[model samples]
Target: MSAKKEEQTAAPAFNLEKAMMDYSGDKYELIVMASILAAQKGKNEEFRFQPRDKVIKASLAEYLAGKITREQLVETYMSERKLMEEKQAQEEKRLEQKAAAPRLELKLSGESL
Candidate 1:
């Protein structure tokens, strides 16, 4: 039982120095992305699953390491944004349709529908 608790409480290992070494040039871009994403996560509950800073750092490191191309990042973000927007639009349309549907309220005082 004690061993299970210890394993569950273990902290994840992080190597910041290695990550920095992996990413080169235009650190400002990474900073901006991280800040923007962090703010978005704070306001949007759906985005809180992954920490913004970690996402930004890992993305930059992967880019520098050539694990993923910059174009891939751009494409991924654009596609995700597009999908989210589309979903929102569909939801709005559904709500509008529901609202526009006629609702019948029968009065109790011998009123006709």
Candidate 2:
């Protein structure tokens, strides 16, 4: 086989520019979404199978495959961040209330003596 053909075969079919154009949203948004996806996927055990591929490429592939969208990714990330913030605030409030709660102390009673 020719070296040129071998090189073509070795290269992935994915075209980054073409994939970005295929995305319905703006290219910039697609890039942002890929970044967010990579971060999210990095933390996920299910996505750990593709350790050889860069997270960003895997993320972009996911977008190209139509498995997810920029809006969905952004919304989900924002909602999760908000929920985490709320949970942290609640924990802080709980700790504050516990600290503020009056502690009862036992006093010696003359009657008992």
Candidate 3:
């Protein structure tokens, strides 16, 4: 008798709602879960999933699970970190310019004048 072997398939994309339904305890549960998963997946050794990444992953999972659409998830990951960094850099430049500015003082006719 001949036996047939099944083809292996990649794991289904993560499902946020299903995960939430499965874990259903707190709001941050999804973030924590994704972080743990990401850590295990070795996405980053620092294992520090930025807030933006956390939101993105959660929303993406939800969309993949048919709970939300890709468009909805698009804005969820938009982070202002880059803008903030640029603003900080500009502020530092301004400060450095100010510090580098020259100061002038004039002393006229001490009391003898």
Candidate 4:
């Protein structure tokens, strides 16, 4: 019973420093990507998170686990940005068309005198 309790109490250890050191890519880029991912995770509930999970740590863990890559992140960001810019352009075009459109004013017969 004591052995089972002890085993259950032991949590898997995660060494961020070691993981960072072992990563084959640029360390600075990794940190930047992780920071961005952490910010996104913190602001959104797209992923189910445990109450004890910290966004920064979770993001790092995902990277370490090979679930996400820096290239994938960059590509996703670029695509989303492109979509936003396209939407803005379309909105601007629509607004210009609306502004250029002609408007008609109906005059009251009683005021014509």
| Top candidate, metric TM-score | 4
- What is the per-residue lDDT of model 2 for residues 1-113, given as tens digits with 9 covering 90 to 100? 99999988895776766777666767787777888888889888877666735878889888887889767898989998999999999999999999999987666874432
Candidate 2 versus the native: TM-score? 0.60
What is the C-alpha lDDT profile of model 4 across 57-113, one tens digit per residue? 789878887888778888877887899899999999999999999977677985642
RMSD of each: 9.1, 5.9, 12.4, 4.4
lDDT of 2 at 31: 78
- Please give the TM-score that candidate 1 achieves against the real structure: 0.55
**What lDDT does model 3 reach?**
0.54
TM-score of each: 0.55, 0.60, 0.35, 0.65
Cα lDDT tens digits, model 1, 35-102, are 44444444555555767666556544445456655565566567878999999999999999999999
In what order do the candidates fall by lDDT, top score first?
A: 2, 4, 1, 3
What C-alpha lDDT do the candidate models reach, one value each? 0.64, 0.82, 0.54, 0.78
Ranking by TM-score: 4, 2, 1, 3
With candidate 2 superimposed using the best TM-score fit, by how many Å does residue 8's alpha carbon deviate from the native? 11
**1 or 4, which is superior by TM-score?**
4
Which structure among the candidates has the greatest lDDT? 2
Alpha-carbon deviation at 36 in model 1, angstroms: 9.6
RMSD value for candidate 3: 12.4
Badly placed stretches (over 4 Å) of model 2 are: 1-12, 21-25, 48-53, 103-113
The per-candidate count of clashes, in order, stands at: 0, 0, 0, 0
